[model samples]
Target: MAALMIQGCGSDVGKSVLVAGLCRLFANQGLSVRPFKPQNMSNNAAVTVDGGEIGRAQALQAIACRTPASVDMNPVLLKPQSDVGAQLVVRGKMAGTWQARGYQERKAALLDVVLESFRALQAQSDLVIVEGAGSPAETNLRAGDIANMGFARAAQVPVVLVGDIDRGHVIAALVGAHAVLEPADRDMIAGFLINKFRGDPSLFDDGRAEIAARTGWADLGMAPWLAAARRLPAEDAVVLDRAGPGRARRVRIVAPMFPRIANFDDFDPLRAEPQVDFGFVPPGSPLPGDADLVILPGTKATLADLAFLRAQGWDIDLAAHVRRGGRVLGVCGGFQMLGRAISDPEGVEGPAGAAPGLGLLDVETVLTGDKVLRPTTGRLVSGAAFAGYEIHVGRTLGPDLQRPLLICDDGAGEGAVSADGRIAGAYVHGLFDRAEARAALLAQLGAASDGLDQHARVDAALDEIAAVLQQSFDIPRLAAIAGLEQRP
Candidate 1:
């Protein structure tokens, strides 16, 4: 079994996308490839075939590899619930919640579990591409880190360091990592790759040489800015603030950027609609009065983000929007927030308490320790078939559920729609992934659909990126570094 680990200089350095592209590239070459992450901290999660949860990025990588996603792909998953605490999932099961300090000490014990999962994948696949979280330059956290060099050494996997040139200081970031890392950790990095380069790659030849000379690491090659990447789902929330394509169409859709937004990729399909103008209203910006649809996205911390929504005066704006006969849709935590009340008696997220919801739906929710993770397929009230997943930690009950928005194949109702049909909330994510469902939803807003299947679009984007990597990356050198025989 052969393995190659990709470690970035910092967060949002495109490590996930790079690993995903490589997975597709290798799989396209007829090699069995699998993606693994020792640890991942993200609210964007995907439900696995085994009824477990893993990072959404890993799910996408699994698609690239033409395999079903499993919990073994990402053994340790962290979903931040607050500034200092997060819900921990070990091997696809909820372990418990841990504070920032508490997790630091406990993570060392998880190294064995991480390696166990890695070995399992190694045994099954011809090659496994592992992704590292954050950066190893964080020497303070380096003592018990299972996310980076710690896992590299434990798994005996050779690493390729990635530096984002678009963020500038690629030289410092690459060479600086080598300087701060321990000698053994430095030895684990087999080479370095430069990512997100904009202008001429020849201009950075000297800069790349400087990094090679300074760190004594092989130069893997530079990747130009990939336009196809935007078509793929982003794992980090940092990209939410980046400007999207120009809003040329008439249908206006706005969603507030919550503090701890989770599964925001649910809107990727909406963003792809050329006739729909979708925007994520940032902090300090009021929800657009002309918006035809206002969507409240999922959040890791429902109560905290609810408070944040109110603090930003979004509640009042939402009321105004509703008063103007605009439409409102909420998913997961957002669905809980739109209810009459949200009670947290066990303090699963934070302090034990309850908060008044928007009261748009006659529903009441109580946050519980037991999480719900499942993949569902059903049709909307309009009979438009859709497939989605549910990942939440609360139970919602109310009268409005009688007018459910979706009726699953199992004969279970899944969401609530107001009497007037202007307000709706669902515990399901990826509600609009289906072309038919998306068309139905847009029909309510006087918009049209191109009948695009989101999953197919993502699959095409992966192939496009793999083609780009075929030209931009040093595949032969990378194979040598990973100790794999190069295929014709």
Candidate 2:
């Protein structure tokens, strides 16, 4: 099989972004490239066109590769509900919930599913770039591990170990990984690349040779950090908590830091605008008193995160914000949280039966029956067309719906808007991804807008990263080094 595995020395080392860049890079070379992440753990997920949920990172990578997203791209997904338990998604469908021990014990039985997805991708693509999750040195977890080295070995794919130079200890981290790996696992490492290097590349000359000598792995190249990385849609679930200035404008939107935040990309377009600045306020931090608008992003566990929000005193803060005539918006779970009460009689999100919302709107939600999953297109009160998708399980209705913000084309629930014009919400996940929608919001806040072309902007950003890689990275050397036989 013509596949290459991108394994990392550790987690949070930009392996996902690197894989995305490589996917775009390879696709530009006239090769059909597909991104594969053997296993993923994140609350941030994307609905596949085929109706399965996959990690947001894999979804973004698929977009970068210019390929249609599929469950086959990410075979295993884990959405953590508690510290020790996670909801397992196998082959794009909800498998079940499992604690740590239970999951490992049962993980091996799912290898066939993983293999099936991998083989499918291999058959469809000229080149498939598989991304490993976490570090490969977790020997204790190796037996049932379908990610990292186990996946590489199972696919019989050569691996390029990527270490983050920006994290410091580059030398030790790279060599330490080699030292910890079993002899057979170490043999799969065809080469090593230093990623996110900031300073002079030549200064790391000695470190590169040292790593090669110690690990018996060839030095592929050192990649400098590309500033355009921020322009790409972040797949990492952690981006839900990423704090940054939004578009430079008079109107500001502050989003509460929900405990189990998901689909935070709903706000990316706003942040990309120079006219608006978006800030994520955590539990202890005070909300932005100057923000003209406040937003409640989506979450995995509405009841749990809502309880955590109450504990943080944000409920009081949100009330005060709305009292002062600040515009408040909610999406999906956020939409649920804006109502009078959220009833989880079935206990889908948490053990708690129900929780009170901020009550800015007169709406109340009942978490019951069936989930709503469908692509949507609708119009604002002004007749402007907007498009997004829905993935929620709750049903909400209130007097506020007398003036709906978005009128659903389908027979689904029309989203709500408060009479005083202080509160609004929709079940749609990406309402702001559209430039015109963002511009309209900015105009409502009396702020300047950029009118950006989101699709072109993302494509240009990927192209810029490819240009950076071409200039700084040693692609030919990397390909050759990645072909090396692993040391015994």
Superposed model 1: Cα runs more than 4 Å off = 244-246
- Compose the digit string of candidate 1's lDDT tens values, residues 1-488: 88999999999999999999999999999999999999999999999999999999999999999999999999999999888999999988899889999999889999999999999999999999999999888888898889999999988999999999998899999989999999999999999999999988899999999999999999989899988889998888989989664476869998999989999999999999988999899999999888999999999999999999999999999999999999999999999999999999999887889999999999999999999999989999999999999999999999999999999999999999999999999999998899999999999999999799999999999999999898988999999888889888
| Best-fitting candidate, scored by TM-score | 1
- How far off is residue 125 in model 1, in Å? 0.4
Q: Write the per-residue lDDT of candidate 2 for residues 277-374, one digit (tens) a residue.
A: 77788768767777888898898889888888888888888778877878989989998899999998976665748877888789999986465666
> Which residue runs does candidate 2 get wrong by more than 4 Å?
237-248, 409-413, 477-488
Among residues 3 or more apart in sequence or in different chains, the pairs in candidate 1 whose N, CA or C atoms overlap within 3 Å are none
Query: Model 1 residue 127 lDDT?
Result: 95
Model 1's alpha-carbon lDDT is 0.93
- Model 2 TM-score, all chains together: 0.94
